[model samples]
Each structure stands twice: as structure tokens, then as C-alpha cells.
Target chain A: MKYSMEDIARFAEGDMDGDERAEFEKVLQADIDLKSGLASYQNIHSSLKMKLSNDDKDKDFKQTLDEVSADYFKQKSKVIPITRYLAWTSAIAAVFVLFLIWSPWQKDLYRQYADTEMIAMVERGENSAALDMQQAANAFNKKDFSVAKATLENVIGAEPGNATARYYYAISLIETGDGAKARIFFSELYKGTSVFKYDAAFYTALSFIKEKNTKSAIVWLRKIPADAAKYDESRELLNKLK
Target chain B: MLKKLHEDHRYIEALLHNDKKVVQEIYAKFAGKIKRYIINNSGSESDAADILQEALIDIYQQARHKAFQLTCPFEPFLLLVCKRKWLNELKKKSVLQVTNIDDALLTIGEDVFADAELLEKQEAEAKHFEQMFEKLGERCKEIISESLKGDAQEMVAEKLGVTYGYLRKKKSECMAALIQLINKN
Candidate 1:
């Protein structure tokens, strides 16, 4: 007897009841081809199960997520920056450009002239000695030294009587890693008028600190005027040296 | 830049430290493999989606906890882990009771689970069945594909422009043809 499609389908779906299953087994025993067909069904189920299990085991879930997420983020970053730039420029460029364009020529010209005048005033206001002192101060701030010493020396050459310049030149020399030359300038400025007296006393102490001569630093610190702003910082440095 | 990683059971562990960039990389690299595996396992798209989500969660856990170490590329490790996790899930379902869990565990060898040759063969077999389904009149193919998805007989009949009785008879005939095609492969 041949197995109909309905019989096989029923069997595949377990539509056969308890006794029907028993009877189907009897039929299977008598027929090799039918047995093979049933086995194929079993194989299909097995293969499907194996494939499912394999899928579960080998799907590389994280790797896939990482790749997709990377692509998405990359796309998002690319799109957002471009769109924001476009929107921002479109919204602002016209007003900003128009403002620049509408500015009066005389105003612009006066602004340049004012800048030039400021430079000229700065150049003429200070004698060569005072200029050297300012240059050395700038160099000290910038941590430049060889040029600073040369500029300080230029100040002394042009005006040996300028105690303010002498004080600053000494400070510059000390800051430039030369405590020896700084001591002489600080001493001269300190002995002169009161203009550089406080600063000179402070830098004289600082120069000794740089030279690691705690004795001379203490002597200069004691000599600094009590009202000088440098008095507190000098006292602290003196304490540190002691 | 190639990341220098610690040698330990910490591949997924490393992933935990990775930013969103790395996570996205992991997903892109493995989604297709997971999808194909789920589909081949008699699962639908929805099933594939669920399985994939679960697999990713598993990887995330393993990674976060420093459980998975990659002796190979991250892709294979993830695949191996997810496949094992899904198989364990199936075993719990008791759909087919006689599975060799040990064999499955052993199957996570260096080059065993997602073997390129096997995937190619599966692809060819799938294509063969698709062609055979195509060879069947289009109506037969639609009816059977829907039926296999567990659609109601009447619904499939209506969808295929056929009466319920004709749909039932035609379904059997179509399934027989599919079985024959499968046998030829």
C-alpha cells in the first residue's frame, strides 16, 4: 500500500493519535521506501534543529552589533556636523558679512592711525635706559635671558643715574640665571634715592636666594621696607631658605 | 588603530571597556551570520530577531563580566557563544529531546561551527529549494510558504486565490514536491 500525502503530512504533524501511531509503525516496518521517507522527515527536523543550535552558537552577536552601531554612529556624526555647519552659516553669514561691509572707511582708517600713534607714543615716552628696563621685564616674563641681560646692560650704559632701571635690570639679571651681576645692580639701586629702594631691596634678597647664599638673602630681606608689597613674599622666601 | 588587549578570558571583557564604536562594530560583523543561522533552523524572521537579541544580550553579559576570551577573532567567539546559548534554550523547549549537548559543546572548535564550506552548501541547498518552489506554479509556492508559516488553512486558501479544499489538496501536493526537491539536494 502506498502512503498518501495526507498520511505523511498527518504523521509529520502528529495528527495520528496513539493507536494511529502504532498502526503507522506497522506500515513502516513492511516498506523500506516509506521508512526512508519518514527518516527524511526526521532528518529535516534534525537538520533544522542543528542549524538552529548552530545559529544560536555561532551568530557572533556582539560583532554584528558593533559593526552596525559603528556604521550608524559614523553616519550620524557625518550628517550632524555638516547639517549644523550649513544651518549655522546660512543663519549668520549674511548679517556678519553685512556688518563688516557697512563699517565706514574713515572709522577703519582712524582705528589704524590710532594703533600707529600708540606705538609711536610708547617709543618716544621712554629714554633708551627706560626702554632697556622694560625690554628686560618683558624678557623675564617670557623666560628669555641672554637678550634680557644685554638689554639691562644697555640701560646702565645710557643712564647710570636711573635707579628704577637699575633695580629692574638687577631683577632681570637674577631671573636670567646670573646672581653675581644682579647683586651689584641691586646694591647700587638700594643705596640711591627711594624710587627703586623697595624693589631693589626685594630683588637683592631674591638674587641671593638664586645664588643659594642664605646669609646675603637674609641681610637684604631685613633691609626691605616694612610697607613694601614684596616684604611678605620676601619673609616667606627667607623662612624657606632658613 | 589596532587595540592591544590583555591575554585572558577577557575578549568580551575588552568589549565592555570599548566605546559605542566597538559595540557597533561587533553588531555589524555578526548580525548576518546570526540571521542566516536562525532562518536555517526553521525559524521565521521574528524568531531570528528574538534569537539575535538574546544572543547579543548574552555576549554583553559575558563581555561585561570578563567571561569570554577570544583565542580567535571576536566574530567566531560570539557566534560560538550565541549558538551554544540558543541550543541550550532549544533544549529547554524540549522540541527534539535527543540532542547531543556534548557534541554541540565540542562543535565550538576553532573552525567548526560557521564553516564557510557548510554555509555555502546550505546556501546552494536553499537556492535549489527556492528554484524548485519557483518551478511549482506561483500560486502553489505562495500557498505552501504561507502554510509552512502556520497560517490557517482558510487564510492561506484565501490569500492564494483558492477554495479551502483545493488549498488543502494543493498544500499536500506542494509539500510532496518540496520534499522531492530536498531529496535531490
Candidate 2:
């Protein structure tokens, strides 16, 4: 009816033969105290085993997070490779073109044209809609009307309600030789609810800059908020208008 | 291997100090073994990933103090350390709560203290298993890995490109051979 401590330890370890294990269970059935002791031993052993097991799991999880983080960095670095390749190609192209043009006057003109084209290329290179709109604004500054208009349209295509893109797109049009089309786009950009409302108003005035309308540029520049980051630049450009 | 593990201790220390490359190397190095240990225990694939990461951190701490003197190969010491950590976590979760904290702490007896020395012996057992695994042909390793997926004989057989009947027989024979090899140690 009773089981020994040695029998209990062996059973807990699961080391006993099947017949002995069955016999020990039968003995445990008859004795409550023996059953309790066996249960305690089994539970403790199981708990330790479980603890060891979870420890293994936690270690594994940390390793996985590390792996995932590494993967993220690898993916980010992959994006930079194409960008670097394009830059190198452009540098090589510039060097080759420079060697072909021997006249100083022709080379200087070519260099200026290349500089403008490179700026246009960089502006068009930005894939982000917001960045495209910013680049469109830069092209408008350089008086590259057609490229600026096309880039702004691309930006607005991605973000239909982008007031800044619309305003810049309109300005590019008006300067490039489409006053009527510019007016409609500018009117729509101004009417819309947008973060670039002030820019929209300012560009409305600049649309007339193509017609040598210094009076309108001054009015629009003055309408720009004094607190806006671009207000100073607008003021300087407005001063040059007269 | 122990020497390599001890050397990796420096790498692990660098990881703890936020060296990104070393952390990546450590992750690549031990992730599989840690995953196996977790999967062998009562945990999911995701749990395995979690356990390995924390264990590495613990090892990192030990390495920082130069306390993780590798007397055995990295895998077993890592397995043991992680096992201990998981057991502690299971206790906290009370998933299979048997004894309370007081009784559990009190149960840390002389034998438990002897575990420090037994670690090296356990490492020998692990190395023995590793040696046996290496001795096994590639097909045997594949069979074991497939069999471990679950005991659905038909499914395992289909996955392993064998008939169910042959698969079962091969599995039993392989398992028996593996047991004998382990027993010989």
C-alpha cells in the first residue's frame, strides 16, 4: 500500500519499467499521502522543464527580432544602390560630353544647359508626390516652364487635391505661354481647402509676372503672411520685380 | 568550439554595446538552435524567435561581465542558459504552476548547485547528440526533420517523397538507431 522515496524519485524521473510504473500507480491509488508526494514531485519536475523550455523560446524570439531588423536595413540599403548608379552615370556622361565640345563659348553654353537639365532631372527623380510638387516649384523658379508644368501635373495626379501642386502647375503654365489654362488651375487651387493656401495666393500673383505685371507680384507678395517661412524670399523677389 | 564560443563572447559584448553588425552575426549564428529548442518545448514558431532574442541578451550581459566562460561548445551552453530562462518565464506565467515561488526557491538544493559542474557533462551529451547527427546521412537528417513536423504518417511520407508504409518503417528504424547511438554514450 505504501511507496518508498526511491520509488517516488524514479517514477518522477519516468525511469521505471512499464510494469513497475503500473505497480507504483496502483500503490499510489491506495495511499493519499503517497499520491500527494508523487504529484508534488511530478509537478516540480514539470515546472522546471517548462521553465527551461520557455527560456529557450525567449532566446529564440530575441534572435528573430535581430534578424528582422537586419533585413529592414538591407532593404533600405538596396534602395540607395540605384540612386548611386544613376549619379555615377550622369558624371560619366558629363565628362564625355565636355571632351567633345572644344569651343570655349559653345562649351560654356553647353555647361549652363547641362546644369539646368541636371536640376530638372533631380526634380523629376523624386518619386514622392509631395517631393514632386516641391520640385515643380523649383523648376518654376528656374523658368523651366514645360518640365515644371509636366512635373506638377504628375504630382497633382498622385495627390488630386494637392493645392501646392495645383498652384505651381498653374504658374508653370502661365509662364510657359498658357495664361487661360493657368487661370483655371490657379482658381481651383485657391478655392480648395489646403495646407498651401498662402502659396496658392502668392502664385496667383506670380502668374502675372510672365506678362511683366510687377504691380500684381507686389500685391501677392504683400498678401503672403509675414510669419510664413517663405515670406522673406517672396519679399526679395517682389523687390526685384520693380 | 568552446574557444570559438568564448571568442564570440566578445562579439556578443559588442552587440550589447549596440554594434549592429555583431548583433546581426549573433542572430544569424544561434537563431536556428534556439528555434529548435523552443519548438522542442511547448512553444510556437513566434515564441521560439522571442526566446532566442532574450537569451542572447542574457548571454550578452554575462559576456559583458566576462562571466560567460564557455567550458563547452556554444550551442549547449546557449541551450542550457535559454532553457533556464524559459523555465523561469513559465514559472512567472504560472502556465504549469505546481509549486509557489517560496517552495521553488527552497528546492534549489545541493544537486541544483551541482548543476554548474553538470553543465559540462550535459555539454558532452549534447556534443554526443551532435556527433550522432553528423554521423547520420543527409537523408536521415531530412527524415528526422520531416518526422518532427507531426505524427501524421501519410503527410510526412508524402512530404518526404516516400510511400507511407515505407516511411513509417524507416522512421521507426531510424529512431531506434538514433536511440541506440545516444545510449552508447
Candidate 3:
């Protein structure tokens, strides 16, 4: 006797009467293919249930995973090159250390904590916007703030909602002595729900510091929560400000 | 026989809870090795990162739904999952010049290997199931999704303006249809 899929489904769902269930179980014990089919159906049923219930939680987890992955890969890529460079520069370490200690840039609070390490954009294709982003990243990393500002302006023109581009563009603006304009972009980013939200807040504080507005900088620094990525740095900078 | 949970189950718990500190430790400890392995096998650091993230998410889903336990250390199991994912990716890309790494280098136990294989199979099935579900008719999709929302059948039936008996019957038919769709593929 061939068992229909509805019969298998009914059995799997426990929707059959006791007598019908008993009869189905008798056949189920003797039929390997039917047993396998029932198992597959049940697996899909439970998996679907789980997937629907956990979809939102899965998205939240993916967001966290993406953030951590970006940070991890960035650091991993730098490790090898930085180590090799350190090895070659170990002989000049004493002079370089002295220079770093007395460097005017090191004394500037705005420059000290402005993490200019733009998250490297993964080159997807030969699209001009992608090319512009790559060029902007290179220019920003090289501290060619003028070029980075120009390139990022073009990127933001094409994709105004590009938060990463906007955030980096703000930093480039600050680097090029346009602290007021940079704060506008930073304030906008801070108000959004991007991963750069706290980073934006922190940079807004830095922008205030660049303008010698220690009072406003303190206010912005205090807004960073202890759980935020920039909280510790903000606290440290707050101490220096006080 | 009940297998003893390894001390490394904390890592699995971390994935479940999205514990960033412990998750970062997992990266700090194990990510470098997996990154090196993938980079050695004709993959980039970005590919390694993607594979690692995907493997962790798969583990998270398995733990969430299947009550997956880590009976062995997490490092080898994580590496095994990531290695398998990268090999599968290379296969999809039709990269013929792939270099295969020996699994023997990692001290993976038999059970860990079996667990990883099961996860890979389940992930493939889940992907197939999701695609097939999209092909289902609107009514069937609504019935199945609404029924799975943990409401009483009568309540769901009322909410959908159907009788309880019809809801149960339709749910069964929808599930059966879904199974057949998967089988047809």
C-alpha cells in the first residue's frame, strides 16, 4: 500500500486519531522509505519554525558579526606589514622616539585621538564610485586630506546616504581645517543608527577640540557611553581637558 | 551515553548570546590560524574573514535550533568548519587550481568531524528549504508562517478568519507541499 504525502504529514503533525496513528506506526516501522520521508518532512517543519522565529535575532547577530569582522580583518592586515617595518626601523627607534615625544602633532589633542584608519573598502568591481572610494581611502590614509575631501565629496554626491564615506569625509574636512563643516557631517552621523554613531560623536568632540572649544568638547565627550567603542578614549581625553 | 561538555562550550555560548568580549577572544586566538590557512589556499584575508564569519553564524544557528554542544575544543572545530566553507566556496567559484590542505594537521576528533559535516548538510538543506518556501503560494505561506508563530491553532485560525480544523488541515498540506518542492529539486 502506497502512503500519500498527506498521510505522512498527518502522522508527522500528530493529527491522526489513535487508531489511525497506531496503523501508521505499524507501517512506519516496516517501511524505511516512509520513515525517511517523515523525518525529512519533520526536519523541514522544525527548521522553518526556527527560521521564522529567529530571523530578527539572526539579523542582529549578523550586524555584530560584520562589525567585528571588519575590525579584525583590518588589524590582521596591518600586523604583518607593521611588524616588518618595525624590524627595519628598530635601529632608528631612539631618534624616532625623541622626535615623537617632542612632535607638535603629538601635543595636539585633536590629532592624537583622531583615528584616521579608514576601514578599507573591499574593491567590488570597476565602478567609478567604488574606484572613488578606493582612491578616497588611499588619500585619507596617506594624510592627503585635500584629495580625500574632493574624492569623498564626489562619492557623497553620488551616494548621499553613504555613512562611511560621509564620516571619513568629515574627518578629512577636520584634517583640512574645516572643523565647522566637519561637525555638520559628524552631527548628522551621530544622529543616525550607523555603526559609526559613537565614532561620529567622538569625532565631533575632536572637532570641538580642534576649534579650541574645550567646553563643548567636554560636553560631547561625556555623551559617549561607557559601552561605546570610544568611551575609554573619550574619558582619557576628558581628563586631559579638565 | 551523555557526552561531557567541553570547557570550550563557553565559545558556543558566546556565539549564542553575542558576547562581544568572548567572541573577540575567539578571533584573537583562532582567527589568525584560519586566516593563514585560507591565504595559503589561494584565498585572500577578506575571503578568510567572510568564511570565518559565516562559519560562526552557522554554528550559532545550529546551537540555537539543534541544541548543538561542543564536546571538543572550539579551535579545531571552528577551523574545520571554516576550512570546509572555503573549499565549498572555491568549488562554487570553479577555481580548479585549488590546493587542498590535510585535516590531520588539526587535532580534530571523530565526533567534531561528524558535527561539522552535519552542520554543513543542515545549512544546505536550510538554504534549499528557504528557496522552496519562497515558491509556495501566498495562502500556504501565510498559513505556515502564522501557525509557526507559537499561537494556539484556534487563535491563529480566528486571526486568519479560518476555522481551527481547516487551519490544521491546510498547515499539513502546506508542509507536505513544501517537502515535495524540496524533493523535486
How well does chain B match by TM-score in each candidate? 0.41, 0.40, 0.82
lDDT of each: 0.52, 0.53, 0.78
What is the TM-score of candidate 2? Answer: 0.27
Q: Write the per-residue lDDT of candidate 3 for residues A43-148, one digit (tens) a residue.
A: 8877776566656567667666654565456433322222234455554754665465346667787767775555444422335765787788778867899999
Model 1 residue A147 distance off true place after TM-score fit, in angstroms: 54
Off by over 4 Å in 3: A1-4, A7-38, A50-54, A75-242, B1-5, B103-107, B151-163, B183-185
lDDT for each residue of candidate 1 in A39-136, tens digit (9 for 90 to 100) = 66644433332222323223344333422332222121211221234466545754654454345453332111111000001222344554565566
Ten-residue region with minimum lDDT total, candidate 2 chain B:
B97-106
TM-score between model 1 and native: 0.32
Runs in model 2 lying further than 4 Å from the true structure: A1-144, A147-159, A162-168, A190-196, A240-242, B1-185
TM-score winner between 2 and 3, please give it.
3
Which prediction has more favorable DockQ, 1 or 2? 1
True contacts kept of each: 0.09, 0.02, 0.43
User: Lowest summed lDDT over 10 consecutive residues: which window, candidate 3 chain B?
Assistant: B98-107
- How accurately is candidate 3 docked according to DockQ? 0.18
Clashes of each: 32, 25, 0
TM-score for each of the candidates: 0.32, 0.27, 0.55
